[model samples]
Target: MHIDQAILDKVNPWLEATFDNETHRAIEQMMTTSPKELEESFYKNLEFGTGGMRGIMGVGTNRINKYTLGKSTQGVSDYMKKAFPGKHLSVAIAFDCRHNSKSLARVVADVFSANGIQVYLFSDLRPTPELSFAVRHLKCQAGIVLTASHNPPEYNGYKVYWEDGGQLVPPQDKEIIDVIEALDYSEIKFTANESLIKYIDKEVDAAFIESTVKHASFNTPQADKDDMSIVFTSLHGTSITVLPDTLKKAGYNNVHIVPEQAVPDGDFPTVKSPNPEEPEALTMALSLADKLNADIVVGTDPDADRLGVAVRDNNNRMVLLNGNQTMVLMTHFLLEKWRKAGKLNGKQFIGSTIVSTPMLMELATAYGVQCKLGLTGFKWIAKMIKDFPELQFIGGGEESFGYMVGDHVRDKDAVAATLLICEVAAQAKASGSSVYQELEKLYVDYGFYKEALLSLTKKGIEGAQEIKQMMIDQRVNPIREIDGNRVVMVEDYQSSTAKNLLTGEVENLDIPKSDVLIYYTEDGAKIAARPSGTEPKIKFYVSVNAAIDSIDDIPSAEKQLDEKVKAIIRDLNIN
Candidate 1:
């Protein structure tokens, strides 16, 4: 095997005395026996993206381990100190049910404490949203959670949040990355300051659940809850910690949990992948729901920040709702309730990603509320909330099964979403309908919107280059038409430009610069292409909609939209 000298130079540092003996032994074994693995692991340092660092767990610069985490923590600590000089600096830390998560949380706490930053660390595994809440509730400057979210078992990650309870954005994200890049392993403070590190659990948990319950809109009578049967699965993650209790507190009684996945296991033994977005992840929950004849089934990812749902359709069969469908249901429900409660003023607004269906904008307009569009990621949604402090942020969601209710927790929160969705089910039952019926009614009132996401994974170092090249090709030779429909407008978020091919006019887009391209067809079809910031994959989001004249027209309208999406995909030659 041929090894690049630059890779070898990067690997030599792991053998130094500064690294632990276990790290040294792993590096030595890889160097002698696995040249290919060694090259992949040492070719470059794991980057701290807009959120934070994530990678496979191993002993290499490219892997996520103690040294890498230490450097990241030290750098965040340094930035916090410099940013808030002469102020009491502190951070909250949380972990999920993944390998080495607890230990990594402790390591993070120790590093923060060693740097004289007060650390409020969870005593055990907790969900990601609670960490964001703790950052605000504890009056800390930043927060960190150790989990790779829905990634495979071999993967782990570190997500950073700022004082506003959102992930780092813009200048802050770039500044933190600069500090992290300047850091060396030896510069990391590893010693633990026991006095500065505080362990918190029950108190914070109680506050978070209270906030979740309080923010939930329960317009239906308590008797409605008795008729709603809900089945929930955490997918061997952290939702088991608080979801059940939250449901009970929210006046739910007929709730059944998928016992097999209730346990917080790091391996996620029951599913091929513990992502709620994938139907396979919710298989056991759906099966159990069928057995119990439940009304709704909910599954959350390992970190419990995102939620996937399966609702009983009109045919009395369990069907998985896509992220866009679920978001529409939740947003519509919230907006309706707010209007009935006389809470919908012009100052209220809702948010959704640009990749999400445009139905949310229609709903917002119907309610006399403003609709805001951000780039992908909940952090951007959270940034929207931060930017418009004068407006009431009722709720917001993305197409990837993530929704945030209220601004109590600034990230996508499954706990609150789970509770609110159950409430929706109860309200539907009371109104002589089901969740599916309500969704169809929404389509009839608005238009029928269908959305599909295709992610093509490119693995390893070579795959990274391929993904970049694919984006470049799309930009250089743009697609002017899709499925015989002329492309009306082209948006390049990276350059913050939007061009109308029909009118031959160009204008600047007032959104953050990101490497994303979107095309709007003459018939209202939309397609967006963006590479995954955290994974080695590129995603294509397609949305198509048609008017539904009545409840009977929903099925045909849905079919037409589905066919349009397929046609768009075929035109782009996207597999």
Candidate 2:
């Protein structure tokens, strides 16, 4: 056997003493027959990081399975008990359309119920954001959603949320990690009190969808009903359960679903990855749009939180909008609608991650609203809402596809995004324009901001070391220039300092410390680098902008700006 002695010492006892007969047999077989696989699987226990637990679904300590799920639930239950003793501790649970997701939800519910915690589990698959909403709506102490988001079919995940209907932050995250580490497999109790495990379905769904629609900018969809033709793809995930109905209820009559990708299938047989952020995931829907000459193409990931869109540019070529472009359009559309309706209350606020395009702040300033800087996640944006009740959180988003409009849900919601995107398209069409036209208008009003993302995936133990080394190298030897543009400022998020290269003066960043480095050029180009929290990858986000005076200059300006961005990327030597 090629098993490492240290790994065997840890896993052998776990199989013999801590697990059941089926798990024990599985481990024994791997140890004897697939020792290399066993060694890799059991070399180290899965680390529950800030992003919660995510891994391939299988029978191993390193993979996501019944034992790991139970242990995580038990640990969370213990923390809830300690934090809110004598209170009726409750949690809302939702699952995506992943393999064994429902079964894993049952296991999680059983653990919580056995621990005397109240569990409000959805009877069918639901989007992840609704779980965040349900936590606070039900006044639960914490929440869990079983989803891998946009991961491949072989993967599953568990996301932990707090009472505020957001992912755990700071002390609570560390506290939960401590409790989870303290639990041995022996401490997990899977026996369930079925009476305490409640099944929630239509009631919650109706309420959530109603609240989501209320976030829409259009009060009456009849005004531009004929102007929009939207093609939506759920990518065989949870959105098909409710998103189609939500759009209909929002008064969008001409909505079509990509037939093959509309069903809830764990295999996700259509796309390589269920992530809508990738253009390939929207291939079928975009093709249909081109054939029908539709107005727009919209897609959601498996868990239905993030959204991606496609539209025709002035050249009549169908193109996908990047995350930053999408956010810019959504923000401009929402605020414009509000202003027209005279709904721009004095205390309205919006938010985006620090790494996101600064153009959001500029656009918000034009509207006389505040654009607060959130740390990397939506949780921080949610935290902003909780901290400042006086300021209404109008919308917030990251450079990634995830976006949240209104605060009914603490997490990003594709249901709301899809409905609003359709409405935005309809409204633009009513004004004798397309969504592409509206985007050009936004660029004319604000500036033309072009952004691109490069993600490099590294796997296994050695892969992690390499990613860490890359970060260290960048920190030690920061870039001084890119594409003939002088690097004027360097923001080291790990140190929480922004250094002005010209002045050699460092100012502390007001956000929390993270392992990110951002480089700003003299000509208004911003580049940010950070490691992914949930996956073995590091991502570089490049944003550049040019001022546009009119819509006619969009094509040539876009071409020139794109060249600058590409040159910057090439100069940085980012793979």
Which candidate has the highest TM-score of all? 1
Clashing pairs in 1: none
Query: What lDDT, from 0 to 1, does candidate 2 have?
Result: 0.86
Please give the CA lDDT of all the candidate structures.
Answer: 0.91, 0.86
In order of appearance, the predictions have TM-scores of 0.98, 0.96
**Cα RMSD, each candidate:** 1.1, 1.7
**TM-score of decoy 1:** 0.98
**Tens-place lDDT digits, model 1, residues 212-258:** 99887565677888888999999999999988989988888899989
Error of 2 at 293 (Å): 2.7
TM-score of 2: 0.96
Q: 138-216, model 2: which lDDT tens digit per residue?
A: 8999999999888888889999999989888877887887898888888999899998999998888888888888886
Error of 2 at 396 (Å): 1.0
Q: Weakest 10 consecutive residues, lDDT, candidate 1?
A: 44-53
